[model samples]
Target: MEKLKESISSVLPVTGIVFLLCFTISPVPNDLLMGFVLGAVMLILGMGLFTLGTDLAMTPIGNHVGSAVTKSRSVWMIVLVSLLVGVFITMSEPDLQVLAEQVPGIPNMTLILAVAVGVGFFLVVAMLRMLLRIKLSHLLIAVYLFVFLLARFVPREFLSVAFDSGGVTTGPMTVPFIMALGVGVAAIRSDSNAENDSFGLVALCSAGPIIAVLVLGIVYGDVAGTYVPVAMPQIADSKELWLLFLTAFPKYLKEVALALCPILVFFLLFQVTKLHLPKGELIKICVGLVYTYVGLVLFLTGVNVGFMPVGSFIGQLIGGMSHNWIIIPIGMVIGYFLVAAEPAVHVLNRQVYTITAGSIPQKALSTSLSIGVSISVGLAMLRVLTGLPILYLLVPGYLLAGVLTFFSPPLFTAIAFDSGGVASGPMTATFLLPLAMGTCSGVGGNVVVDAFGVVAMVAMTPLITIQLLGIYHKYRFRPEEVQEEEAASEDEDGGDIITF
Candidate 1:
């Protein structure tokens, strides 16, 4: 019961934010009230269940599979299996589906499949990097440089969305399991330095979709999608509300199944081979899976039905307001709260604090991420109000992040890049994207060129902010050591004088 309450508390702020946004911004007559109540309840329940589920089901399963693969004596088998696992899991990510649905002019499934394959290939590369102990920063520099160069050739409109894909591909469904996999694989490494290797999987997996989408732009050729704001439906009666919930239920169930299947298959394979958990543990995991399913269904329904429409409406209202300058500050507020609301951000900070032995505090990470996202949201709003090209922002953003990579600690750099992807989770998709879309529609700008990059911007800013924190940490810690040395010298000098 206490555990359940903890989960509810974790999820409530996000649900509350969605409800608040809906109440303030929704266009439908009764939607604000109806959505507020319904969205809050459903979202909280969903989040609690999902977090519990991932803890029980996904994490263990991913870890077991990862360990099993590492224990396999055959290198060829590990590589083959890793690649297949990567592709399968990438195919299952719910966020990717959301992204695919929003992208116009291409078949949704085709684009999704392409992105999955790209992620899969990269996941294999990431696993291999860990096995070989390759430096993450060096790889990131090369891949991002290639991505920027590709951006030059890709249509201007597709550039931001392409980078956005890199970030969104590492959503809730992907992060926990993939991180577990990294931990599992690293655990099995016989090398004394295995811990150092665990840090880079998320960093490397983030690159896959960017490269895939950039190639997609080349193939699809500069076709931009039109933005349409989702209309909020009024819930006049209990019957209508019940029907809406029922309708949304199956969609999310299918989504959860799709997201869970690849990891499940790997688990099954592991159970058959070197990685067997006790029957009781397996049963616990099954229960967790149920929680995950329930949580995801509720989470998606609340966000899509209530949050998305509200976000779009607010963006439109604010963008259309007589005092349009308010959008910047409002956007900053929204971004700050939204990052705090992301389930994965909590996970990232906790994990980083644990791994770094408190060298990186959760509060510091949260503060840095919030500030970074705030700036990004402000910039995204500016993009909507003004017709500036995404490249102008992205090019310099990546360059700055890359330059920082050279100066900061390798672990901080790895974590910073990973945070970029992790920061823009489901909240960014369901709320921020819709907000950008609505604002773009209100301003009569190109949705693909203008609105599509909010996720990209949200993702990019964290890379800079987290690294800046790292720089500060390094500087401050050095002074403390220096002060300690001076104090030791004074003590020695006083001991020699004695009488004074």
Candidate 2:
């Protein structure tokens, strides 16, 4: 009941904003409006179920896998398992599928496999970092620096898509599992830094897709991919609307089933071989999996069938206006409220609150993410309006994030990077990306170059704001308390060695 209320609260603001826009400046077609209303309801219900499902099933599965693998004390097994887990989880992410469909010139499977491999490789790197106790800041600096340098060799058209890959890769499907995996891996260590270390797996995993897509760009060499516009559904009556959602159910049901299958098989492998838990617990996890599957199917169906076309139409309508500059402020406002609608966001916020022992309030972190995404959407709109190069914004935004890593507390730095990935979940892909694409179409801009990077911009800004939150957190403490906490962390720095 509490979770349902939270989901309702998260989704209502965005629904209100869309309806308000429809009635006023951007009057959507009646059919589109009707779809949006139905989609919003499904979104709320699906999100509630999904969040509940993750808590019961995904988190426990990740924890079990991480703990069991680490306990084996075999580096080879850990690396191999981590790699496979990353690939399968990423391959199953629905948001990545959404992104792949929008991108032209590349086969969906090719892009999907490429992104999966990248995430798998990076997950290995993240695991190693935990065992080695490497500083998250320094590693992030190097990884991103390498990413940008590689970007120089890729084609301009592919740059935004490549960057956007990073964001979508860490959507609702991946964040909960990955973050819990980090916690499970960190559980072996009894130290102050363990909590801080539990973060940053998502951070590195996010980068993996960027590098992978950029490399794909370089190899493909300026293959021009065009934005494929979504055709609005024609609904003559309420029955058709009902049928529209009803028909989508099978497709998403198949998709969600396939997505969850790999994870389920992986868990069962562990259950039979290692995690011989009580039958009662197994029943609970099975129940949770059912919820996860149903919730995702409903959620994906709503977003893809209902929200997407409406988003594109709204953007097109608004961008075609004489005072098109309004799109910037409007985008900013939508982006602000939209973050709250993301399912993975609630997961991230709750984990951050738990890991930090509630030192960082969920409300504060949520606000920072909102502010960051608001700025990102505004910038994304500016690019659509003026044909600004993505690099003009990305290079500086990342550099600043890199610089801030040095000053912010390590926990904050970790949380900040994780926040970047979490902020740009399904809502960004289904709605905001379409919103940007629609605006670009209306404004006669290069949709591929201008609108494609909205997800990337969404992914980048929270790295700064959350760290700024961290900096604020750093200063909020008294000098003595800060010194004491720092001293305590340092003392446990060399506590033990149990690497696998």
**What's the lDDT of the predicted structure labeled candidate 2?**
0.90
Q: Model 1, stretches more than 4 Å misplaced? A: 1-28, 190-192, 478-500
Models, CA RMSD each = 6.4, 2.6
Clash list (residue pairs), candidate 1: none
The model with the greatest TM-score is 2
**Model 2: per-residue Cα lDDT over 79-134, one tens digit each:** 99999989998998999999999987788998999999999999999999998898
Give me the candidate number with maximum lDDT.
Answer: 2
| RMSD of candidate 1 to true structure, Å | 6.4
Candidate 1 residues 1-500, lDDT tens each? Answer: 54457556555665565456545643434645576567657777776777778778887887787888887857787788777877777777777777777877767777777777778888888888887767677788898898888888898777777877877888888888888788788888775446555766776787888888889889989775554457677777878876776788888889888888877777877787776688999999989988888788888887777677667777787777676767777788778867876667756776677766777778888889999999999998898889788888888998999999765655677778888888888878888998888888877788878888888899889999988887777566775664454346335431111000
Q: Estimate each model's TM-score.
A: 0.91, 0.97
lDDT of 1: 0.77
Q: What's the count of clashing pairs in each model shown?
A: 0, 0
